[model samples]
Target: MDENGKIDTRTAKGQATRDRLLAEALRLFAIKGFEAVGTRELAAAAGTNIASIAFHFGGKEGLYGEVVRHVAATLASLYQNAFAAAQAESRAKGEEPIRRAHRVIAKLIAALAASNRSRWMSLLLQREFITPTACFDTLYEEAIRPCLEEFSQLVEATAGLAAESLDNRVLAYSLFTMASAFSRNGNFLRFTGKTGYAPQDIDAIGRAVAGFIDKGLRPSA
Candidate 1:
């Protein structure tokens, strides 16, 4: 509200500018931690002036907080629908739990491949876990937890473990770590060797990733 007690509204252009700043901030922050980056750098990268950050996000620190929320929400929106469809297909077909798990993992891997295709948001997400901030808990709760529950459910079904058990959570985290590794360091991985994994090769990469996860979870008997 302004002095007149009227509600404030952001114009379309204003919102676009704010979003652009967030995008650039996320990219730079992913490559270089927040403390290392300055407001001037952000303005230069975002094509806006330093005052704009304070105007839109309150300040540099505030922008960082908003960036976390934006990225977390983005991941959820990007994957939740895809996940739901995979789950529905699995249930309708009465697929074996392991097969269903394979499908889920494959889809997840395919998504991961393209996650960093157009933006740094995906890498930015991975960076959070490496050096957590105040927003980590919110990210975990609003985005990570739901996704983890789904993966853990599949793992539990495949492994005959109870829900949310220590074993299940550990397995889930392990799977997550493996799944997110490629996107987090896709360029570095490519530099090391092609490894026959390319984000553009969605089906091939999905099969490879899903197969790896499935085999890793196979029963001893």
Candidate 2:
């Protein structure tokens, strides 16, 4: 950017600066929240000047908004891709709808678990839930709502209820909570006297969660 703080992110160097700022901003904002993280700290963390934050994102508030947008986009992509792949696999194998839902939940849990920044992302989301800002709408509309709607459709198919029905919506939300718990397992770890989970432990957790959900959704013989 020039002295006037006019950002040109189309260029390689400009884009790199913007990316670094966003990366560092996400970490800081997730850990310390938007109000607590100052412009100087953000710039120092990103190895850029304060002017770059203003040029690239307008200001600290603007940068926090962009960080939320970035997080929303990332989560939306993960949810969509996991759901699509699981649905496609189910169709190819002619699996039942309940089983398909189970597969989707399992894949989503695994994907979230495998994300390097899942804990940070979860912390950010918890903040949003506890204290919503204008950006929370962006996250809900872009990521959370879409995923809930799609998962509700899956729940409807398995449970033979309308997707918009209260029961179906509750079921969908509950299933999602179960799947996403792996990403926010700090409380669980502390309670269980465990430092962390291995890959196999995550896999086992996924299977156990899916089994309970599947049993709950199964129709009486």
Candidate 3:
């Protein structure tokens, strides 16, 4: 079509526009909180029209849900990949399942630390926990509960414990709590002089958490 004859794809441009909109919307939601943002404001922030939001995502609430789901799905995929890679590595090295679980946990923490969206998800999750919203059910059913269940099974199997045992459930909750706390409040704790761990100190904290949970889950002597 031109002197150089370079083809321009409409699909690619559309995808780019959608991604840009999502990115801007997420940033605004993170800064202003979801309830504080309106469709017109989101559209302007995204450098698009209000109609674009409705066309691309149905409506404002739909856009918000999609954003949340996008971030959740990304985090879930990262965790799943980390778990699989850890398992493969452990098998190659002939490491015990318990050690593999610890390695997986460490990998998860490192992955979370490296992800900006994961950090935002953690903040959003903490907010949800404190002030439950209608979206809470969707998030719980779609993301949180499934992750907890999978993690519970993994922890129980790694520990050589019965899955339905009280100790196993308690250990699962403790590990989940520790992980969520580390992601949500680790920076705040360091800022307040309560804990000195730096943002990049995931390995040390991971090891400590693994040891603490391991001991807590061990069968009574």
Q: Which has the greatest lDDT?
A: 2
Q: 1-221, model 3: which lDDT tens digit per residue?
A: 23687655756766666787788777677656788888888888777888988888888888877777776677667767877898899899998677766776777676665566666776676666677666777667766776676677877777766767886777776666677777664565667676644655767778877776656555567
**Which residue runs does candidate 3 get wrong by more than 4 Å?**
1-8, 131-134, 158-161, 185-200
Return the lDDT, model 3, position 34.
Answer: 83
Residue lDDT tens for model 2, 82-154: 8899889999999999888888878877888785576667668768978898899998899889898988988
Off by over 4 Å in 2: 1-10
Pitting candidate 1 against candidate 2, the one with the higher TM-score is 2
C-alpha RMSD for every candidate: 3.5, 3.6, 5.0
TM-scores, all candidates, are 0.85, 0.89, 0.78
Please provide, for model 1 over 122-141, each residue's C-alpha lDDT reduced to its tens digit, 9 standing for 90 to 100.
67777777788898887788
Cα lDDT listed for each candidate: 0.77, 0.85, 0.72
Instruction: Report the lDDT of model 3 for residue 151.
Output: 71
Best by TM-score: 2
Candidate 1 vs candidate 3, TM-score winner: 1
Ranking of candidates on lDDT, top first: 2, 1, 3
